[model samples]
Target: MKTYDILILGGGAAGFFTAINVAEANPRLKIAILERGKDVLTKVRISGGGRCNVTHACFDPDELVKFYPRGEKELRGPFHTFASGDTIEWFERHGVELKIEEDGRMFPVSDSSQTIIECFLEATKKCKIDVLTTQSVQSVYQGENHWKVDTNQEQFSCQKLVFATGSNPKMWELLQGLGHSIVEPVPSLFTFNIKDNRIKNLPGVSALASVNVNGTKFESAGPLLITHWGMSGPAILKLSAWGARILAQKNYQFGITVNWLHTSDAEEAEQILRDIKQNQPKKAVVSKSPFDFPNRLWESLVTASGIPSEQKWADLSKTQLQKLSTELTQSKFNVNGKSTFKEEFVTAGGIDLKEVNFKTMESKVLPNVYFSGEILNIDAITGGFNFQNAWTGAFILARSIS
Candidate 1:
């Protein structure tokens, strides 16, 4: 059996990070990363639509933890130690400069994920960390003190093992056999699939809206985008992230109440309509979009209100005004399915946080076994929070092992 000091499974964001940091920390300690696929960093190449959202600009630990629906409480202390500033500085030191966007998402200034891949690849070669690809992990067992890992091609022994598999069921099963519990994994960060005429044929329409999943306590406020298939964007993505577990329990069938204007209430929306009628009485209700919504969305809303396009605001009846208010403030739509969000696939389950030590990303049930990344029950909404979790946990693990 080939023996090494440490072995990392799943050659992904966390796996490569742990390997690089550990090797750099101690030159003498041997480290190897086993990747199942022919290539490594496939997800990294495609994350953020190929730009690679490295981290969020949120420097505050408390605020950063709020983005994660799971592991928020568990990762509270971890974020304080390795927050976004630490990440920014670390990348800068490594020749990869990240720029923060207006929305606080940080990405490589070069706007290419290949920069990060090259950095990691160079780091491993410089640090003498082995990168083994096409090596599939079939089973893992703990000997008296070390781990005996069986792969498709070979078996190896390592004094320490780290798992960074993101939403991979086989890895979860392997951990389960080792006496560690695996939480039931569910999809997160998905866009809602709604078949409603109000948003149909309006693929490019978007507005500042707040969505509440009716019958559940899930609500999110942000810019919502209308697509041919359904609704998406920050608000919808946040709702999906926060309500992953609940929506899964509901079998992805639920109702969502969307406030297009994000106004206070129905009365407030009604008043806004009344003001529009009072001010722009001569203009068509569809022509004068009082809200900042796109004309397509405004026209759709007006049509859905059972009002003609040529109907002037002055000709609108009280019932039409009330119905329009309801449509703008509390438009309920049926969500029948979900679609993955552009190369970013996240899940809300993994190793139960209770069985792992968040301080070290180490498994409490196993000896010398550490974890980082999506293998754990920690996931965030959109933006760069998910990658931040992986980077934070992997950094901690590297330092702990070193």
Candidate 2:
């Protein structure tokens, strides 16, 4: 049997960060990370299309916590300890400078996730931390004075243990065996799989809009993109993240009301339509889209409103105008299923928040056993918020454990 001062399960971002920080804080303490798969940092390789979204540019801790739907209140204290600014400084100190995009997602200046991976590997090597792969953990329990972990290949014990495995059911089960309650996991950050003619053949079209799930108070407003399958982007993704459990309970079958004009109300939309009718009376209704929407999308919405291909603004009756206004302000679509957004398969459930002490990220139910990343009930919308949670939690765990 092997032994170490600290043992961290999973070799992903949270695992590596915690190990490195703990080793840095206490240079003489031995640390090792056990990874289930042969490859480590696989998620980092595909995140942000291989660019690796390190974190967001949001510096305020309170503002940062707002992005998280689950751990908002719990993370308020931790983010004050080690938030996005700390993450940026840490990466910069490690020689990996990050650049922020217009949308606030930060990526390495190298524009390659390999840079982040190499940084972690280098830090681990410098700290003399072992990263063991293909060591799938079979079980974990407190053995008197130490934490005992049995992997498929070997057995080990450590004074302190950390579970950084993100959204792994087997790990959750093993943790449950350790007397921790696991929240039922549900899919989050997915796009609605909608099949409708209003958006058919207009896959590349995008617009700033507001979307709300029917029969629920869930709502979001941002840039919405029309995909071949349905609608996606920040607007739809925010709704998905915030309503992960509710939508799953609905079995991914529901209806959504979309406001293409974003902040425009029904009355405002109708007034704008009437003004356009009076000014552009001779022009084709579908040819000149009055709003900032794509021409194809406008034509489709016009068609859905029962308007003909060559309908002029002057020929529109009262009913046709009302229909057009409704289509522009409150379009409805049926969502039959969901599609995973790119490679970001985030879940909204894990170890219950009450079972974790956010101050140290240590399990309240198990001493010396810590949790971080998606292993906890904390998840956030896209744009590097999830990774920020990982960094914050892992950093706090390192401080407490070391």
Residues 1-402 of candidate 2 have per-residue lDDT tens digits of 999999999999999999999999999999999999999999998999999999999999989999998999999999999999999999999999999999999999999999999999999999999999999898887889999999999999999989999999999998888799999999999999999988989998999999999999999999999999999999999999999999999999999999999999888998999999999899999896889888888999999999998989999998999999999989999999999999989999999999998888989999988997999999999999999999999999999989
- The models' CA-based lDDT, in order, is 0.91, 0.94
Pairs that collide, model 2: none
Which candidate number would show the highest TM-score if scored against the true structure? 2
TM-scores, in order shown? 0.98, 0.99
Error of 1 at 183 (Å): 0.9
Off by over 4 Å in 2: none
Q: How much is 77 displaced in model 1, in angstroms?
A: 0.7
- Write model 1 residue lDDT over 293-317, tens digit each, in one string: 8888888988999999899999999
Error of 2 at 341 (Å): 0.7
Report the error of model 1 at residue 58, Å. 0.2
- Which 10 residues in a row give candidate 1 its minimum summed lDDT? 287-296
